[model samples]
Target: MFNERIHRLLKEISEAFADRRDPFNNEWLSKNDVSIDELHQLTGAVSSILDGFLAAPKETQVLLLSVGMAASSFRG
Candidate 1:
């Protein structure tokens, strides 16, 4: 279930990035200058990480989410 959800989220993010007419999208891509292939590779990496998490036990899954939350908070 988590794997599927993460895949969907990555797909949504990819679609948002690919749609060039979006103002924020344009500015973001312009600033970052990521190639299409690089973005595809990143999406693949995200899927692999999600797969690893899904294979872990339930307790570990919660721990992973907690770590991710902390990391995101730090980024902000």
Candidate 2:
């Protein structure tokens, strides 16, 4: 997920999971110093960005999603 297209969007999630926290569980994040409110805000921003991307031409969206994506996301 360090594709630079989305700026390593899943890196933080990977980190939480590697640290033995449930990234999908808000309770885990809340109890582990991650603010749910901030997560919500960041999600909102991502949603907006995706919406804008969708509004672009089909070629643009295709290029953005396909180019420079998925260089590496796993290290085990």
Candidate 3:
């Protein structure tokens, strides 16, 4: 489940990069000379860190999920 969550985040990041006209798209990253592979590398690091966060208390887990959802909504 944790890995899935990380994958979902990475997917969102990819979609954001692939689309430019979309309101929630990451135009800033695209405009600033960011690459899709760079985003993947960044998320890879994040996933590693989040792996430990996943082992925390239930409250922390809920917080992580909430943050993830918020980010998704922002992406949309």
Q: Rank the candidates by lDDT, best first.
A: 3, 1, 2
RMSD of each: 9.4, 6.7, 9.4
Point out the higher-scoring one by TM-score: 2 or 3: 2
Per-candidate TM-score against the hidden true structure: 0.55, 0.50, 0.39
For candidate 3, lDDT tens digit of each residue in 1-76? Answer: 3455446555655465446434234774555445677567666666676787877899988898788678667766
Q: Per-residue lDDT for 47 in model 1? A: 72
- Predicted structure 1, TM vs. truth: 0.55
Residue pairs in clash, model 2: none
Superposition error at 44 for model 2 (Å)? 0.9
Tens-digit lDDT track of model 1 for 1-76: 3455445445445455445334236565455565676556656766787899999999999999898667555643
The 0-to-1 C-alpha lDDT of every candidate, in the order given, reads 0.61, 0.57, 0.61
Clash pairs, model 1 backbone: none
- TM-score for model 2? 0.50
